[model samples]
Target: MAIPKRFEESFADITALATRFGENEAAYLSSKYQEAEVRQDFLDKFWLALGWDIYHQEHPNPYEREVKIEKSVMVGDRGKRADYAFYTAPNFLQARFMAEAKKPSRQLENQYDCFQAMRYGWNSNTPLAVLTDFEQFIVLDSRYKPTVERSLSGILEKFHYTEFGDEEAFRKLYYLFSRESVGNNSLEKYVEGLKKAKGKKTAKAAPAVQIQPVGDTFLSELDVHRENLARAFKRSNNELDGEELTEITQRTLDRLVFIRFLEDKLVEPSDIIDRLGKKSGSPWRDFANEIPRLNQVYNGIIFKPHAILDSPNFAPNNKTFDEVLAWLSHKNSAYDFNSIPIHILGSIYERFLGKTIIVSDKRAKVEEKPEVRKAGGVYYTPEYIVRYIVENTIGKLVEGKTPDEIAKMRFADIACGSGSFLLGIFDYLIKYHVDWYSGGARTLLSARLRSSA
Candidate 1:
């Protein structure tokens, strides 16, 4: 295939920019040359050359733009901003990939920078992202859950500023990240090819190493929390029986996790749990007190006071409550609940249902239920299968139907385990309605309302 004239022009511009950076490396690396400066001078040009409408020159409408600058994504209680979010045209809402820019002085190879970039991508459910500092460009596989401990593991490719003029390097960059390539599904195909290659390599290895999914790892963490909390509650309140202990422990953890989710979704104030942790009084009590207000707003049974746990006699030590709250609300906590999908949360709950708490020798322990043990183990339906079932069944039912018509139709899953199928149905409906409203229907509705008035 021949290189297009536009690509050649872009290559010349990138080469000139690289030359400028090389000639004044020290000045560019200085504190005076900030991240914004590098982004405007180098990062912008880099993406622009790749055919991204960075400034929306061709697509003036905000919703039609292929790139979003400084898009704010919620991470736990805090909001993190991505420097650039590239998208395929017509799907301007969801980003295809993110680009994080740093000043030339900053090291892109550092764990902090790598983890930050991957975290944004993982949280947003984006599959790929780029981290650059004008001096170095790093491509990251964002499908993996990011952790500061293993920040470098997800990196796919790396290149230095000096390599910008190299034909091979530029071609690799263009093929992977150019807007034309992305629109043509080149990026997806590339990732799929990488996955197949990885699977083949792992299969041929002497001892196959299975890379655990984020959901399984998170479920393990939840099991640990349940065990710890169960033991702590039993130790603190000896009067409680096994059933009471189990209920209280599960309810407490469920409430805490839900609050964290709400915080990340921006439904609740940031760090509501953290603020509760800072209280001199019982943090659990403070949190429990806030539940009523939450229930008033959201009107759900999850926030409702439990019959036994809410009793005055069911008090666990303040120290125990404080520790759990601190573990969740601490700045360095590993879990980012926002990144986890609703189906994954449902899967976790399904597994949780298969376990029970047993009190022996004044100690509480989590154990598999008799039925679950008899059946071998708890089995969760894979996300892909659930999506397929939902689409084939519900998709057909809602075809060519208006939002009101779809709303009137009832969908049911007879053996709904943790409501995964129902969640899939809900997700399909939301997207369907949004697409409908965003299209011609919205204008028609407005006209109808105006005519009636």
Candidate 2:
């Protein structure tokens, strides 16, 4: 493949600038200015050379800027900012890449630099993060975790401007980055190829049995939708208080998740979101009208039998609904109801149930329940933990017994918050009975199980 003459020229100029700056100004940079100021100065020129309109001047249109410097995101109490975030389009909301810059004198290969960039990229759900100073550039795949043990050696690439003219090296950098490639997701494919080349070693290292939860990613995106939903509801109904806003958001999440799960399962009325997406007016009303039908289909998960769907439309307006739906429908959703383990939902909900969403001054947010905090924070018992207790207590009594032999098994939980343990026990009983009957001389265990059920 031929390198474009224009990009070649830009690279030449950038390499020349980098060489001169390294020789002349690298040593004095640390003494003259702080990290923030150096980052701004380098990014203003470096990003522009890479075909990014960092200042939004090339495209004067508000939504047409190739790059945006949005306000810092608050991870918790402290606010952290990405030095340069690049978007696939002029729309800033479609951010696809991130760049974190360090002072020219600071080592870009340190764990701190790599970890910080990785966190910001993962938080934004971007494919790649660039950690660079004027002298060196390191590209990190943000999908994977970075560890201090590896330093920056695990990154996708690390190179200096001294080799900018090497065709193979330049091609490697350009193919994986170059604005056009990153925007088209070719970069992601390239990174995935690298991971795949390692074969089963990598797969074995990160197996399904590892028990890593997607809860953080799910909760983060859920929180975003929750905030957006609350704001939209408040705008539509000013009389809503913080508590009301929280309740409505919680119900909305429940309804949406239930509908999405059923849709994925190909249950009846499987296209609720699809149908709702096609409509023009407020979607919540349509959903409300269908509540009775949904309740019948889903066994009353979304709506209870005599419950009233709040008037004035409990649904978000069109724009908000579209945005929220788009977020939920992203290609890499945290949890896929179809393939995810059933108990994983209960595990996630266990943590969720330990908290409540409250609006502080009309801004709905999640807060840990006071009792949960006093009891040493939200802790979800692992499925194995629940299984152990159930097997010992419930398992022994039911041994050597047929479904008909055992008329009924009684169990109780004094402190049942989310009923995850209870569900585990119920599942145990059912499985034990099914296995016992099937392994026995009975050829028609299906009928026996159905009768017991």
Candidate 3:
């Protein structure tokens, strides 16, 4: 097949850029070249040639743009902005893939660079992402959860700047990432093909590696933390019964998780937990001291002082508290709470709430609560099911209602479990109200009033 005229032009431009870089490699690779310069001069043209509306020229509305620049996403406890996020038109809110750009001086193959890109993709539920510095372009498979230990894994393709001119290489790039191809669902199909091919190849050699979902993995870790905290508390306060121990342990874990979630959402400073983890004094005490202030600011039940748990006598050693903090830290943790949906957290909490700590002979062990066990264990309503139910019921009820009318209606779920149903309803109502406002509801109201007058 012949290369399209647009691609031919892009290839020529890229070749020229490569030649210029080659002539003064040191100068281009130096700090003076700058990331913004490379982005403007090379990357912009590279994507524009792929038929992307890089500047949203065709789509003038900010909300409807196919591409977003410097899109901020939560990664661990802080916000990490992706250099570019590409979307299929009309579904502009959900990104199809992310592209992270760095200066020519930076190596794209490093663990840090690769992991950063992968985390953004994984957290956002994006299947693939690109990491490049114009020096090297890498396509990464981001279906697997990212971890520091597996930072280098999941690299699908790598291309040097010189490869941009090669017909075969350029063709591959076009098929994989071009706006037309992506819009036609070619990228997803290609990823599926690769997975099937890999599965066949690995079938005879070894067992398939089971990739755990982020929510499940986090829930498992939460269980371990709960066990550790429960045992530590039991050892410290033998007078406390199993119920008291469980309440204290669960409350402490809940507060920590809540604060971490806030930090990732940019509502709290990133260092709030990290500073406590690194404190010379008791980390538990320092963390406890921060809760009162947090409660004052947020006025929430999570941070509110618990009569038993918040008492000075209700103390766990610094070591146990520090370990939990270390596990939740950005450097050590795999979770980006901001990207993980609230429903997933609710699901985790639902499961966590079903289990209780039992103390026997000074050892604490986690067991399913009797009610949960009788009910055959905790079950979370899938988000899809919840959404479907909400759409049919709450969605229909608020179809043309104003925000004030919708706000007056109350939603109830007697067996709420994790309150997933309520959350789905809340999400639907919020979107309905926002759409009503954004779609000139006020203009309609003004017209109606004028007609009456």
Give one clash count per candidate, in the order shown. Answer: 0, 1, 0
Per-model TM-score, in order, reads 0.73, 0.49, 0.82
Question: Worst lDDT window (10 residues) for model 1?
Answer: 205-214
Pairwise TM-score winner, candidates 1 and 2: 1
Question: In candidate 3, residue 17 scores what lDDT?
Answer: 71
lDDT of each: 0.76, 0.62, 0.78
TM-score of 2: 0.49
Clashes of 3: 0
Pairwise TM-score winner, candidates 1 and 3: 3
Top candidate, metric lDDT: 3
Off by over 4 Å in 1: 1-70, 73-98, 103-109, 121-129, 140-157, 175-211, 317-323, 437-453
Give me the runs in candidate 2 sitting further than 4 Å from their true place: 1-212, 299-301, 305-309, 313-317, 330-334, 439-453
Clashing pairs in 1: none
Best of the candidates, TM-score:
3
Query: Model 3, residue 284: what's the lDDT?
Result: 81
Q: What lDDT is obtained when candidate 3 is compared to the true structure?
A: 0.78
Q: Which residue window of length 10 is worst by lDDT in model 3?
A: 1-10
Model 1 lDDT per residue over 331-413, tens place: 65545565555666777889988888999866889999999999999898876787778779888777667787877888888
lDDT of 3 at 185: 90
